[model samples]
Target: MWKGLIKTNRQKEFFKKAERIAEEACKHLTKTDREASFSYETLKVIKDVKYPSMSLAKSEGGEGLSLYELLLMQEKIAEGDGAAALSIGWHMGIMMELSQEQLWDKAAYDRLVKQVVTDQKVVNRAATEPATGSPTRGGVPETKAVKQGDQYRLNGRKSFTSMAEHLDFYIVSAYVEDKDTVGWFLIDRHQAGLSIDKTWDTLGMRGTASDDLVMNDVKVNEGDLVELKSEGKPNAKGWLLHIPACYLGIAVAARNDAIAFAKDFQPNSLNTPIAEVAHIQDKIGEMEWKLMQAHSFLYSTAKKWDEEPEQRGLMGSELAAVKLAVTNTANEVVDLAMRIAGGRGLSKKYPFEKYYRDVRAGLHNPPMDDAVIAMLAKQAISKD
Candidate 1:
């Protein structure tokens, strides 16, 4: 879709450097104590660098990193602040998927990637409805798109539209009944009939402003439809490697905080640091071990997807497993971080409470944990 990407050794090194910069910039999100209260200025810094375009490849104005390198960047960014990382992670996934579907063009992608590198202008998929849950492909949409001459009219409201107010565009999924099938449309915030119901004051990911998108009769060109046949594809990969990668990073961020906190933490009334205590040490050890496992699994999964980047039937089951595992793992890690921080952790003095809230959303996020497990069970039985 775009050209002149970094496929050389220098470019790969640049990607690593960009990730390090993001890590250094975002490191305080976990330690903020009251992470939800964080302002948008922090996210602005990461966006300015267009670090989200890590998947663009040097040819398309990005580093063209393999899945392993991509995961490395995600882990580093999430370690900074899970919510911020999570907000950005969905965009990373979106851009990659758009490119894979041959929807991204040099004009929009180039300009957008440049601004994305450094701005708070988020790009995300707005498919979840207050009632529809995961908005999985083939899952009937509460929102409908009606064809009106050359343009389409979108009318509906979406919940958990992450980064709503600050985003540049929303790649929305709605049912286009004229086709007797569902379809996706890219709606720009600047369009008429589109408004943000600025009610996003999330307990966690507060900085993300995961607000609501209300469309009365937003008109957009049919050309804005990024993927014509993407919705009901055999596998419906809406929640695949992308979203999980973000939460996966956020989960790791929790682990990173726990490790750092324990290393220097002094137990109340005890003469030794918490790291010296057998029990605390044990918990920290578990956090570390678990984090390693997540890293291995997520990295392996991304690599496999990239290896066969075009094998797009549907990996709903696999994506669900990743989301469930990482979300659970992230929740545990943040919980443990809270425990390690003690009551002070819950206090607005550190990020534990906010992380707790943010991590909890993963449980409710589409590809719900229950759904994934059930699917996995079915897959197992079918194989048997």
Candidate 2:
């Protein structure tokens, strides 16, 4: 069995819970992947454990886990089921961001946090749109919110709303007509005009339920408007490290399966197991080296985010670089594992195919590789 990086009792407890959740969630992966359906059972387990609220401050009735801890948990969960990890990662990241930054309206956010902690409800931001592309690209939203007496009527569609099947509250982004700027509105799931479009068919991470959110004149309280769009570059988001952590977990899964196959399988032409073959040993060595590099890059960066508060604001490039490097390294590790396992790796009897597909999805997530590289390039070439 592959060893984990956990060192302390606190992380040990969290890793155990995450491992249990992953084991339970893995049972449904084949069915979900084949049918492109979601597993509500997996979500029930997560909510029962209150995994989403673990990042909240201790004063706010949460475990107050650090970024490194949360990322470690996220990685562990992804080892069993990437889709489940990806879906829950959004909720965990959102909760952490809210508690750490207090970027939303105080009263409204406090009420929402109460509901989240007590009711075990989950929240995720609905920001991407069909026309505007990714929100990270600085595109103005096509969704519009018009003020009407003590209410704001929102009518537009949000794409890639992950965890849509179970999201209790969607922090939706829209153009506030009165304010002439984009703002985030905390829209309730039970709102009259809100509906899910269920159009999340994809090659990988299909179980994320990243469908479209359709709002037709949905009304929200005036105070539900949580945050307005800010000018200039956004702050460094250390919580997004969960994205690379997930892919790394998938890579670890692939490596484990390949090692097992190499140890057990023996061809008639060879008296010994393939694990003893020189070329096979080479592949395993490369996989281990890459995994070590990825693990170091991800955990060290997350530890910095947790222990050094004063430097976080200036870590935007470094944080994105972690995502770019770890995710790409994960992609390589999965591919190498597939090679070691041979053609059978692609068969449904094995899981390398799934890991291969799922790891690629991280490239499409926010703070895309091209964007991160461009930011780094400009930072290097410009005058200090």
Candidate 3:
């Protein structure tokens, strides 16, 4: 817990609120982020409790949490539901960049931030295309944003959009209007011609509603082009990896779940709790140990960025290292969680199945481990 977050006679109440949110989320831990379904009740709890606004500056109606502390907050919530953690993470992570860069008209930023905190809206980045691939791989978008009178017409098929269906607005990527530039347009989902093409069938993050965003000439005003660039490095936007932090939180959550389960969950033949089993205890111990090491590497790097705000954008080496380390741990921790669940883990009724699929998403995320290793090797050899 970061110092001074909830300072009042209400410290007990705050923890109670926090615990209640975790409890509510725990009820749906098995739901697929792809569930992409809306829950007014759940969303209301999040807004009232204020986790979406966790990263927002207190001065700007946010919690004023530092990046490192925000990461910790994300970890705590994710221990309950990985998808909700990420759905919220995507919004906060984007806001951090907008604030850092001072993009958009002040009014829009203000309204957007408020909506995020209030649960009135959600924003996501749409950057993938069928012909190309992930925006991560330097794939240029076939999606075109054409400038028209008083507006821009955007046409594209974007895949792998996180939280696509539920978004109120999307900062969609396309070849710049009649140019070779990469452009990002902030188109509202309510605008005509923007539609969710299909429900995503991803194995993980199912509750996130990670769906395909389709635009067959969506119209947008100049206000929509929040960012435009003729040329730049693909990795210039480093804030994207804040998402990995959310995934890391999921691992932490699974670790906690396993430990608590071990305390009382008894197998058919076991007269006592599984905590008494040496092998089970060892598995739990090793997972905790791995989490500590992973945090040591991750937290230090995050703190370095916060303590020195000048460092922004992704360094292939550092970001890759963070992604590789945390994601792998998430996979392992979740596996141990499933193993602890025994045969029950494989069933849909068990949250372990959902956690298993969700954790795998980390491994596939870019910068893929191989890419990171190769880049690190190059950097090491070159520097040496």
Candidate 4:
């Protein structure tokens, strides 16, 4: 197992801490999902552990952990509670990106990192506009950031702003009037003209608090603008592995539940538990097979990204393939687990229904299945 590969004592300690925190988070997941509310308690636990700062530089008040370690921690958190993992994953990813790329202005970025380290501030990129859909689709954002004398007035609405109410900062993407280019502006939650509509009623991931963010001329400093490279090509980001890790954790939870239920569940007519049933065993085996395949791909890609930084530039296709495979397999595993549990899976008494819904959300995450396939095809054809 990858855990055995963790040689350093610091890494092992961090992994143990993550496991403990995840267990605590799992205790509240039922109530968290039932209310369809953000898991503030879980967030508090994560904050107490300072998990968000795991990826920042040691000089920047972080543990200076590798990307692989961060993904492992995220998977553990997702096993306990998928919503909490998804919400915190944004903060961790953003911090990691800022730590490595230094894309944002130094002073502003430093301040944000300080806030994350000291106050446990939560932040996420609010880039998905209602008109533009996913930014990956290359739609021009309608969100405008008009330049003032020393500030930019940001105006427009953003959708799927996960952890909306709990965020201290939002890395908002908007069309800049002066540059005629789309850029990211860091906006604080307390800033005037910024409000959440609480319109996040969704089929799954209800606890993500993915509400609509309405910005009515929100004001931010000129320095708040994050600089972008002239080239528009997307860079390989290992942080995205957190997405697949979350779904895989949820699938693991579902599989464990199904196995336990099967071992104990006995029908009135049947002399043995459902574990003795061939059909039930078949479903469990299938789920295990899918999980193993997904885990191998996810960890191997993460390890490669960590060990071979120079090769990251050419990993776009491989990264997309991992995301597609892991997410799709997670959904399949959860479905099989549900099947093993029979009608109980559909009942509110079990967690399979929630896992099913949450795992499906991964299909809509970045590197959409259709786009991944197209990219793979383009790469293959070009090579030939």
Error of 3 at 188 (Å): 1.6
Candidate 4 has a TM-score of: 0.96
| lDDT (0 to 1) per candidate | 0.66, 0.90, 0.72, 0.86
Worst 10 residues of 4 by lDDT: 1-10
TM-score (C-alpha) between model 1 and the true structure:
0.81
State the TM-score for model 2.
0.97
Q: What TM-score should be assigned to candidate 3?
A: 0.86
TM-score of each: 0.81, 0.97, 0.86, 0.96
lDDT of 2: 0.90
Query: By TM-score, is 3 or 4 better?
Result: 4
Rank all candidate structures by their lDDT, best first, as comma-separated numbers. 2, 4, 3, 1
* Error of model 4, residue 278, in angstroms: 1.5
Candidate 1: list runs displaced more than 4 Å: 1-40, 103-122, 137-139, 229-233, 236-239, 308-316
List, residue by residue over 188-304, the lDDT tens digit for candidate 3: 778999888775776677776677898998888877777776355544444556667667777776776677788979878998899899999889988887877777767777667
lDDT of 2 by residue, 1-384 (tens): 235578889998998889988988899998888766668888889988888789999899789989999988999999989888988898899899999889987899899889888988899999999999999888999999999999999999999988886899999999999999999999889989999998888999987878999999899989999899878677889999999999999999999988999999999999999999999999999999999999998998888888999999999999999999999999999999999989998898989999999999999987899999999999999946
User: Candidate 1's residue-wise lDDT over 198-241, tens digit each?
Assistant: 66655666656677899998898867765544433355453255
For residue 377, what is the lDDT in candidate 4? 93
Q: How many residue pairs clash in each candidate?
A: 24, 0, 11, 0
